[model samples]
Target chain A: MTARYLALYLPSLATDRIRRAEPGLPRSLPLATWEPFGNRRVLTAVDSAAADVGLRPGQALADAQAIAPDLLLRPADPAGDARALHALALWARRYTPLTAADPPDGLLLDITGCAHLLGGEAALLRDALVRLRQVGITTRGAVAGAAATGAALARARGDNPVVVSGIEAGVVAPLLLGPALRLPQAMLAELARLGLRRVHDLLGQPRGPLARRFGQDLLGRLDGVVGRRRVSIQPAIPPPDLAAIQDLLEPIITRTGIDAVLDRLLEDLCAGLRQAGLGARQITLTAWRVDGAVQEVAIGTGLAMRDPAHLRRLFAERLERLEPDLGFERMALEARATEPMAVAVQPSLAVGGRRDEAAMAVALAQLLDRLGQRLPVHRVAPVASHWPEHAVTAQDPHDVDPTVPPGWAAQPRPVLLLRRPAPLEVVIPLPDGPPSLLRLQGLAHRLHRVEGPLRLEPEWWRNRPNRFRRDYYQVELASGVRLWVCRTGLPGAPRWLLHGHLP
Target chain B: MPSAAPDVPLDQAAVLAALRARVTRLEGFGRAQHNLGAVPVCEGLPLPGGGLARAAVHEVLATTPGCGAAFCAVLLARTGGTILWIATGRDELMAWPPGLARCGLAPASLVIVRAERWPDALWAMEEALRCPAVTGALLALAPPPGGGKLDLTATRRLQLAAEAGGALGLVLRPDAACADHTAAVTRWRIGSLGAGHGLDDPRWQLELLRVRGGRPGGPWAVTWRAATGRLDLDKEATATGATRHAAG
Candidate 1:
């Protein structure tokens, strides 16, 4: 049996995504994706407006500026472009399950026997192109007999497809060798010097000399392009481990209806998770609106949990934030991240302190979830260090136990530690004594009493050169304010800084 | 303020006392329960139920601006578990992690929340107080404009929330006169006495201006010993004060 493949190339995937996201932007403006290349910035991708104005990819930003002063440049997001390509691949799964992403901006699909369902190869190609256009991406695609690489080359060359099989070479021969073969600039220059600009020019030469000069890569590519070699497309695996979808007969606009659907979906998902002995750490709810927009809300659990009630509560808080304007016709609940849940919690006779502690942990987790909605919530964990700032670290609440630090009572530390020591202008007695007055943020505080200069220096072996050597003092102002000040640098040119306060 | 007639019978008085006891118990005031348990503030400073109530609102007023925040931090450090510190300025509380550690609070045990206005700060505090995991919630509020949201109504909501969640709610108001009517169960005026001679402890004059259902005492000089989590009272100076007590 013969194979069939289709390759779609989106040259300006980054700019296309930007255009789709901001449809209000003027399309006539010359927009291009700029990327840092070596010591200079180069155009990585260009929109049709920029392309029409004769700006090409890999052109230096300075050179482009000389050509078109009105050229609008946006920093290219390569990662985001890749993600968009992957999403397109996923969307293509509606046509065929065999879809793979060709990075930077391309997708490959093994349409094989699936084209007939979409009314033959031409209809399928038209459907794909039309859908991509609706999504704001300009695409070029081709369907070839059995060569995946040939279809890719055909798309890249912007040529009609070789759909009739056995004519791959005929279709590829007349195309310029530089673009059709995707060769290096030096090789293309040499080929041009030899008056061999087209594939047909190279095809007329004897194989022996071509192998000796251009090496085996050219022959391999040629073989792959002409169906002599079978090049398979590796499809990306989809994630649907624990997901439930609900379709409504009519659009649901009310909160109650959405909540009901979410409740049913969560129950369905948790039932599957329970049967599989797994718990979800991250859950995402996507609402497919009637207006073709997708509204999504996501929540995470500190502990691996399969309890439907808890999951519903977490989603409930987030659901209020998701405004499904114009209503939604379908909703999907997916557990993006999951882990094995504890089979059973030990049952105590009276539900004693251990139970209370467990309940407290759960309460804290819920509080964290709610608090994190408005602002970030972090857990403070003690680190083994003598430097004040290095003594503790803020970590994700899920990763650390929110318990009191051990041996915290013995320390003589300030109530509030500054993220960094702030500088304080001081009126020192000058010959190495304590300051008589200190000024912070332009507020003068006369030092009524002064404590010792507790000289603390960074560990010499642990730290690099220019390690801080500070003489700390506890100073009290006449207005009854106590401050922690430090004197650093050499005694001849010492700088005074306020470190903290002892309330 | 007791308006009972002098001619009241003994049996009637006994019935009245019994009824009041029942009402107090039903209202959750008869129990010797403190919200976050209590910090060991020096002796002679009488605290009802042997310590401060856990599920109640307490106000700390700084006699001077920029003075009471440290005191509030010290009180918060004494309460174990995670603390939610909400203030108007985002960066205002960022500098407190290390200093909070020195004051016996696990430096990392706090979640700092920045709100743009007093109302938002008050709302965040109330919400935080209702979270059981948040054993303590402290709000450092700049004095609100008169008749603003930081009145009896707002503090009352905070009080109810703290009580419901069994968490302590502390409001630190610097550079503001105390409101005549507030829902706070206790109010303390804090003034710094400054640090002592070389190697001496930091001192503060704590005045227990008002306390609901208990005696208001102090204006007492207390030295906070950082090495050990305890408050040392200046016994000789405190002896001159006339004792005043009120029955709850």
Candidate 2:
């Protein structure tokens, strides 16, 4: 036997007045609505009474009021309407796994093999409508062999849910109305002018002429509704593993209780991961409150981890942000994109060396998470320059250059290096050369021994016009203290400053 | 703070113990020799025999504003782990050492912690080192001290924390006078060697005045080649001469 699929369509579900009825206001009330405008109002919707009195949407609210003084008015709320539609869609998920929202106020359910459980297609439709009405939502459902057929049948006629099955889609294609074709109003008008007012009228024409006259869009819509074309629903988010949910017998608000529940959930999630031979790098914990609101907290790890203890520790830090307002009734934990851990094979004796790099990386990641990147550790290298300040640069620790030679500082260099060599007021005994007396840091010191007139010309290409030529000298103060100073200009020139000193 | 009574010997012991404990903790359940692959940089030190300084804290004092303080900090940080560069005093003077990229220290691993004042900068540096999970290095540029009592007890406490956490600490003292007493295990003065002819690289002369277990007074000249970002020892450049001066 061939398998059968049923497409269930819900329509007229998103109207605001029909939705806002507390017990949802009686559907019989004359509901007129308006939205805010600059010192004016624009009408949004009208109930059966107001519609009968010619109070259509987009009419002025003042004119609407003048025409019907007793009209019950309410503001249009698109967000609230969307939320209600979303909730209804979730509720519809009980009937099938492929249920999706049609937006504004409709739901599409691909009840492929689920109809027989509720008796038959008709019975399923009736059961769904009945449940919706009981929840204060007046709904209409149509079940057809295909989604387009069901949508067309549900919107074309107000008759009880249509159940068309077993026939080829083309045979019943003519019965669908113009609006059921789901085309824009202008295109519909053009089709109407061409005398192709309904699906049957459009389908009877030659394919080549129809495509030439009304365009492929009209033909495409016709083909789509009759099952000649395929349409796929793109889900907002991909489904995750272990969609486990706990419905509380009572609400829970305490942090300890929430943490306990989380612990249990994490264990279950970990068990699911282990069973699948995988680990999760990120986990999201959601708390569903009694008032139909949900709060979610997500924690991500540096590496894929399956340990429940570590997962718990990560989540514990974020628990304070998940306040259980009005008490939480349900908790859910989901693991996404599980993959097997990449285990490394032991190396042979021929390739002997330390294997601590990975461990160090993991430790570094943990430290980064805790400290938030405040460590000033980095790799340093000597920059090419005669100027002391430009001689070296700092790099990151993780980026240690393997190519650079080590232990290259065994020659004579000042242990106490200055960032910028400072100038000094020096009193030289002779006509040229190193200073004998120097005044620096507001103190006078006698120079005992001095070395170098290491002159470095400024980097002319750096775009700085007034760059100085420095002459550096390593001077030993009278107290056995060594200092690194630089003289600007020539050996006999006046510009000089004391830059750095040894410790 | 009377210079903390010059507890160099006690400080060394405490510092070494702290470093050993940190290395052990970082190594976790594995034996020191077994986990030798974990910290390749510190692997040069033998296990169970002071594997690595728990958290080695040293001071680099320079007279000039733009000396190679940041460069030394970067080296220490890259070798140690994560690095935090705390810049105090003038903004222009405090910068990342050049050629840092060639050394493997990227911007992501090097964190520049900015502070307006010296004391605050020191405090911030201490706090950064206290985090155990950080397992990195802390480098700060301090202002010139006005008195002889440069007892950084709070800094010592922070160093202890860093040791416990398995990190290294380096404090860059800028524009401070050279004194007879110091709390650091190693103290060095870096300056420029004599200029070379055209096409020859600039040579840097480093004088190791005070080292915990190493000889002092020998000047180490290193030639910094800009194009390659590498430091080379210039063995030909000998120390000029030492004119001994009597201590006051």
Candidate 3:
């Protein structure tokens, strides 16, 4: 298939970059950016207001200041201009995936086979130019069969599309050779000195002489213009395989309007995912504002999901956070990360109702997604340890347990383990026996019945050795409350603390 | 609330039929006694539908320190399905995994939701209770210092959420006076009655303080029977102030 390309030229990019950053700057004032060249300062760029006053770029800064005494001048920022231009190119990916920055104020889009989504090619170019205009930028663009011809035409016949095919020669025969092919300034000057201004002048000449004179550069550019050689551009973004984009007829300013657009985009995106038998694990919603700014919000799910309703619910929680200043004209939804719908899950526990394990896992996942959105939800997995506090750890709800989990100790343990042990003032009637009474925080608790000390030695395999073996006593208070108290230190230097409570 | 049982003799078949009708009306058609699926507390205690009501909030207040958590563990185990144990804020009385395992609760089936604040905890509980995938939700809310109080509106919201999803809702507080205005289907005060005559099995005093639709019973002594994973109720052990002398 013959490639189609759209060249977007921003003639006033430098001045607009300054104005876009400080939007409140008066457009009535003539603006110019100046740069220091050795010992002299020269004007690098001038806005339309400054141009109207006959203040042109490349003129001495003092001369321009004299011509337009009210000219507003700022330091030239070439680096910032290139970065913003690249960002604009990345934003253009919403129109077509193959987009690249055509530096010093231009962008190129490989919109081949992508025109049908927004009607024919003509409508697409018109839509893009109008959207750029809304962002306070006046740009010119053109679409043609060849990237070389399209970029040259965008400069000369802005906003027009080359409608016919195989007439690339007829179209270029009338135009100057400098634009018909992207020749260097030196070559164009030399050709002009020889009185060869129009492409028609070169058409009658042999290819050997021009190839020798321009060192194959002129011939290669000529071949690219007439679609003889297929040249490639490095796209700013690789583009997502699955995405849905909407170019609004009128800028959407209200939440309801944005929501309606999102509904359509999600429907189309989810349908594509379902058709591919894949689900979106993470998705990004990008909104291109009329003021040339883009905002994006992302949502991630616990499991790969293609359910439009669920996705919509997740986005609804976050959409309110977006700032839709001056309204947005274009929106794109992309599945940034995806996975096959059948991700494996361990069906360790039986969920109630007459559903299979797979179906139960799906239900549980959805439930977890909904609950987890507002709060943290997790389960305890038994860690391989003998210490009661370190025996179990909090993990994701769906974490699979070992096929054969560690066996429980022969003796009973507390149901609730305190993160920190609570100290108790013990009054032991017997030196080697359980405490007769326990005092905690000025409250007195007398024991009703006591069980013997169950000695638990610390795991010596650990780097830190346990200095004292824990002597645990399951004692019942007179109120019939069970407490698991531990004598943590040696008998001579005993430190008593309540470790856990039994149900 | 010592209301009398029906004077008319209940034949075996007639009682079974009555139970089936009640279960069908409360839950749906053909659901066994396992599914408006109440906590299977041993008989003699006055629980709505012969056990603590499911799909409705039940307040389990600890008159004694550890008794409430013990009773809640048993309820969480027998009430059925995926359980969510929520500890509101930092002053939570979380049941350790090993201890709850002793009560027959499989750690695999339980989810522990830890919230940073009281409102968040209630919100989490309501969300869990509303999901049909969760069969039971237990919120451990401490009073005053670290935890916030659950007003009538909060409990009502939780009750409505539980009703919508058909999951058992349990709220364990530290005291009987914790919530003056409660919308719970039943209010149970659990206290320890000491180790039963020194056999290593500790007995708890289960008092049915209030019931919405059913008459209140119990102040009954029940021991945790590990082998059966159920409470063993002692018919003759319903004495009040039994621990008063031992308190000194």
Clashing pairs in 3: A414-B99, A415-B95, A415-B96, A415-B99, A416-B95, A416-B96, A480-B192, A503-B70
lDDT string, candidate 3, A1-503, tens digits: 76788888888998988887888888899999999998999999999899998988789999999998989999999999998898898778777889999877788899989988879888899888887887667788888777766776776564466545567666766677765565777888999998889877877779998888778877777777666777788898667768998989899999999899999999999999989989898888999887777788888787888889988987887899778877988899999889887644323333444235555566667777766766778887877777776677888776756332557533677777667888889899978778999997798989887886888888777767555688899988776678889998876889998888765
Q: For model 2, how does the per-residue alpha-carbon lDDT over A1-503 read when each residue is reduced to its tens digit?
A: 32233343443333432544554565565676679787789886665567888888778999998887877777887677777766655555445545666765466777777788779878888877776665445566677666666667666656655555555355445564554776766777887787777677877889998888778887787776777776655332344655445556789999988988988888888888877767786677867665445577877664566778867766776888987887987788767556575442111211323334444444444433333223233445554555455555655443444443342332234433445556568887876577888897689998866778776689877667767787677676655455667767654556767665432
TM-score of each: 0.71, 0.54, 0.69
Q: Lowest lDDT 10-mer window, candidate 3 chain A?
A: A345-354
Candidates 1 onward: DockQ, in order: 0.35, 0.10, 0.52
Tens digits of per-residue lDDT for model 2, B112-204: 555655565665566566544344454555554421234647545655655555555666655355444554545656554433441224445
What is each predicted model's overall lDDT from 0 to 1?
A: 0.72, 0.58, 0.78
Fnat of every candidate, listed in order: 0.51, 0.11, 0.67
Place model 3 in a CAPRI quality band.
medium
Off by over 4 Å in 2: A1-66, A70-179, A186-213, A241-251, A286-296, A316-323, A335-340, A344-357, A369-503, B1-52, B56-135, B139-161, B170-248
Compared with the true structure, what per-residue lDDT tens digits does model 1 show for residues A143-250? 887545545465557753536677877777777776566678888898798899887787788988998998999877767776778788878744546888787889
Model 1 chain A scores worst on lDDT over the 10 consecutive residues at: A342-351
Better TM-score candidate (1, 3): 1
